[model samples]
Target: MSMTSDIYKTIAKKSPESLFKDRGSKFIGQAHPVKEEAEIERILTELKNKHSKASHICYAWQLGKNYEHYRANDDGEPNNSAGLPIYGQLQSFEVTQILVTVIRYYGGTNLGVGGLIQAYKTAAQLALESANIKTKVITEALQIDFEYALLHTVMRIIKEEQISVTSQKMELSCSITLAIRKKDLNSIKKRFDAVFGLTVITENF
Candidate 1:
């Protein structure tokens, strides 16, 4: 997707756990759809508690509509063996606002770096493949202020354009907040601007 595009891909929900085994070691993988950085810690804490006996809990996450933010953690595994390979799956799938974690259970065998990479990558791939992927559009909030007399005109435009009214205050002077798709902002803004007595302001999310 283009840098300017407002469309993005993300998992719809938490994926069912996936398992991979190599050299007697077990790797458990899961994918989660997360919106904010704060959610990551809570998820990790829960996973750590659930699999307290696991050897390593490696993970990777990508956030933002442009996929501008990301993190990868190898836990106690060798360097890039675990985390980087898992992260590669996120890029390969072109998904953002998601996290993939791999839990390892030592089976009395040491799979060197190469084996670890393959194991983690395969586990993460399986988790994602079982997930429900979805496409989403980034949206911006817009505030419109106009006199009550112009309410009908505004409502007409809103209905015709299929704009979502997030909130509205009806009085002599009325105010409304609209959720607009980022891609359609310019054209929609221009249409509202043409209304003689209407004022439109973009609100920062």
Candidate 2:
């Protein structure tokens, strides 16, 4: 995705589990696509339960189309050694709306902080590399209201603009919600505003 574009890159689904070994320690990494902060804890809990014997579970996640919200957790590892390294990989891959977790199982030996960073970074990178990355357009919803008599005109404009109608209520009066690509919002809104008796309301998503 281009830096100035309304498109963003994200994982399409949960990635296959990946593993990295360093000295005697084991690091297992997995990446998941997430939309809300609430989903993060649930995923962590499931991983904890699945890896009950593991020593630590470090993770990092980026959310929003603009990558506005994010978090990193060391989960008991040395500060900056585990979570930050994992997060760096997310930045390196230029992906958002994703969570990458590295589960560690102590193998009876201590990898120094440097070693731990390398191990976690490699694990996270491996997980992301195995993921199905996809580019998605950022969109906004527009609520359009018009009279039934003008349905054909409104529908014609929608078709011409290739806009997707997400929901609609057609009666003597008509109300429809459209999902508009963020980049085309201004031009599309202008077109609808020019039509007499039509109302357009912008809804950010």
Per-residue lDDT tens digits of candidate 2, residues 1-205?
3557898999878999998998788899999999998899899999999999999999999998988788999999999999999999999998999999999999988888989999999999999999999988999999999999989989998999999999999999999999999999999999999999998999987
Query: Candidate 1, which ten residues in sequence have the lowest lDDT sum?
Result: 1-10
**In every candidate, how many clashes are there?**
0, 0
Off by over 4 Å in 2: 1-4
Quick one: how many clashes does candidate 2 have? 0
Clashing pairs in 2: none
TM-score of 1: 0.92
